[model samples]
Target: MSDNLLSRFLRYVRIDTQSDETSKTFPSTPGQLVLLEMLKQELTELGAADVQMTRPGYVMASISANTRKARVPTVAFLAHVDTAPDCSGKNVKPIVHRKYDGRVVKFPDKPGLTLDPATSPELRTAIGKDIVTASGTTLLGSDDKSGVAVIMTLVERLLRETKRKHGLIRVCFTPDEEIGRGVDKLDLRMLGADVAYTLDGGPPGEICWETFSGDAAEVIVDGITTHTMEAKAKGMVNAAYLAGKLLAALPRERCAPETTDGRDGFIHPIHVEGRTERSVVKFLLRDFELNGLADKGKILRGLCRGLQASEPRARVRCKLRKQYRNMAYWLRKDMRPVELAREAFVAAGLKPYDHVIRGGTDGSRLTELGLPTPNLFCGEHNAHGPLEWVAVQDMESAVSACAQLAELWERKS
Candidate 1:
């Protein structure tokens, strides 16, 4: 089973499915559709029923219960297929460290690249375990692929074990999650699951039930263009200078990513493009509380207004768009799923730690769609980068935990 998990994970990561954030298409990349078809075929071969790969690349499958129980609530497991666009996902080559010696492991070909324990203290816990990593070139794509492997392995285990009783289990692989548009084309009505769990978190035995309310802010500054040789104080109000002023005017100590923590709001500038004639600044705003989110937007607008006043010759425009809300609102009302997950982890001989996610997940958006979904860990660390790695023991534990979760759900609902 361990070999199967690693083999499947390695196979899935070899396919380049990097999502395009700039694409107007549903799946974002055509490569994601290819993987979706592969998963659909594999599920069919594993004897899963109702296997369907939608046009926009949403793969759905179901496993019927072997028990005679009636009125059992259906459960679903979800994971995304596309990897982060932060790094290249092409031609990923994974290397396995067998029985690690609690020392820093370096790439054989790249002497300068090494997984330093001093930099990442978390390596101590994974000592004496098998770890899969990239070749210090491309990301390993374990963020959600590990979750995919967990669900697939659990389903295969259930099918092989004849006596294991479970209700209908639905599984889905979504696309474009890295760009925050994963569930935009999701058909929840057809999914028909009473509740679902997204196996997309990091670290083993970690569960996340809360996330930040997110939004994007764009500020455009238009100015008159004048030749640099003929530039004067009032003749040309440099839009780039105006953009810099606006960025500086934002709460320096308070609204920064490095200084913020739990429940703290932040305004992160993601993109900046400017010239003397025109400039545009793109930022992402995140807050755990609704009122705080509104206040952050107001602060951003106030900065733009102040910049307009300082540079009267330049025109300033601000646009704020709400993305997704905090999942805590739904999790608070229904704590049964959280309790069930905790019990499942204990049953699988692992310690469960519950925390609020620093970033958003597909579970955040699924909760608002009336699913009340929460995120479970798949043991991948340093995601979206070339240094990504996942322990073999942790992956096995995740598969066991997923199987136990299905049984726990059967007993409760």
Candidate 2:
């Protein structure tokens, strides 16, 4: 059977596997287990060894070494099964643009939403190529689904094609990556890979190892509320007003998601819940520098302190938590894994380049768990939103890269 990359990607995204951030469960969503189960079954049908879906809804499989090398390192590839909750993943309608003509494409479902070439110059690369996107009502889910399809397609080819020589290859699909809980319950000891690569990056040539040091904070305000018509300032502290004051105290022009770009960190309020009696504001802080992340947290604490001081009657408290760190701190030690990826790109007749993930990946947490995992490009563009798209050719390139990557490792050993 010919590899239908787009068909696989579109099929997976249709399942509405959006993860929940507020859930206390390990995977945080039952829908993700359905996708994970499907992957596990498919891997078994593909004759992959040790295919199993663990309790936490993780699907792991292995392809035995076909090469004669005695010391080939075990290389694994990973992708997340869950989609981001920032947009609606339910009832997603995907649109496929055949032979893109280097122009902006408008969506029929959404009146004003269009894939503009100016804002996303990456679309220019898809000129004269096939592109897959969503219909502006929902996200395309290419951020990691494209990665899932690329790895699954590659695994099928490797297991079927007898002449393809490679080392022991492992693959895993994780859950809740968007909520920063992807690897929290992942059993790295069971994965048992010397080094790994996450097929979860945008563009074809990008090889990401450096990601932002991340942390999160939540501020809660408690107010003494009474009837608004009967109260002047008598023991009535509005939580909504205090929440607004805390948000307003932050410097938006200096360190906000909208105002910052490459190498500059930003602090953004991701979600907020408000009422007259209580309010909650959650923020995500990111920076390439450790000191910068710490400073953002410090500034947030100071703002909360001032807000509390000003609104003496209201109770305000801020709790900060650590998320993930830059993977470069671990990858730079040996650098061989990155070197092997570059060699694979060269072998696959493509140019390899370095990239930085402004956000974290399963790789970030996996690397922190003592496995050197770097991110590989899998054709995701305009991720986590309505304008998301993927070039079919970039996915083909990723498949070629994955196949040749294992071969490169076997040759070196």
Candidate 3:
């Protein structure tokens, strides 16, 4: 089982399915469809029925139980196939280190790069385990590939082992999840699961029930451009200066990523482009609470109004668009699946730790679509970076957890 996990994870990561945020297409990149087709073939070979790859790279499969149980709830397991756009996922070389020595391990390709224990405090807990890492020149793409391996291995194990009594299990592998457009083209009716769990969180034994309510703000500043040789301040309004001033007016302590954690809201300036004629500033606003998020938006708009007042000749326009909402809102009454997940973890001999995801997941949007989905871990850490790594043991445990979830759903029926 462990060998299967490692081999499948390495195989998936080598496919280079990086999502394109700038693409107007549904799946974002054609490479994602390549992996989706491969998964469809693998699922069919594993005896899964109704295996299909949709137009936008959504792969769906179902495994029917041999037992003659009545009214068993159909539980689904989901994971993303595309890697993040933050780093390169091409030509990935997975380096497996057996029996880690708890020291600073260096990559062969990049001698200067090493996994330092002092910096990554999480390594102290992973000592004496077999881990898979990258070659330090590109990301390992372990974020959701680890999840993919867990689901694939669990399905194979259930198909081979005749004694495990489980109900119908649906599996899905989505594309473009890293770019916030993963669920945009998802067909929930085709999936047909009463409840689902996304095996796409970081680290083992971690469950995320909450995610941020997010929005994107685009501020465009229009200014009159005058020739450099033209007389002093007569007809010149520097748009770049206006952009800088608007950014500077924002609260310094509340704008940085490093200073925020655990339900703390922030305004992150992601893109800044300027010329004399016009300038554009892009920011992402995130908050866990709805009322607080509304307040934050008000503050941002107030800042823009101030900028407009300060620059009479310059025109400033701000557009704020809501992206996704907090999943916590629906987790109270619509969270039986989360409770089942906790019991499943305990049955698998693991303690479940629930945490708020600092970012959004496809599960967040799925919950709004009436699936009532939550996120589970697959043991990958430092995702979207060259230093990303996943523990083989944790991956195996995740597979067990998934199998346990299917059994629990059957028992509930």
Candidate 2 yields a Cα-based lDDT of 0.90
Best by lDDT: 2
Model 1 ranges with Cα > 4 A deviation: 108-110
Report the number of the highest-TM-score candidate.
Answer: 2
Per-prediction tally of clashes:
0, 0, 0
Tens digits of per-residue lDDT, candidate 1, 104-135, equal 88886467888988987888889999998988
Residue pairs with backbone atoms closer than 3 Å in model 2 (clashes)? none
Preferred candidate (TM-score higher): 2 or 3: 2
lDDT of each: 0.89, 0.90, 0.87
Candidate 1 has its poorest 10 consecutive residues by lDDT at 225-234
Give per-residue CA lDDT, model 3, range 115-142, as digits (tens). Answer: 9889887877788889989998889988
User: What order do you get sorting by TM-score, best first?
Assistant: 2, 1, 3
lDDT of 3 at 85: 82
Worst 10 residues of 3 by lDDT: 250-259
User: Which pairs of residues collide in model 1?
Assistant: none
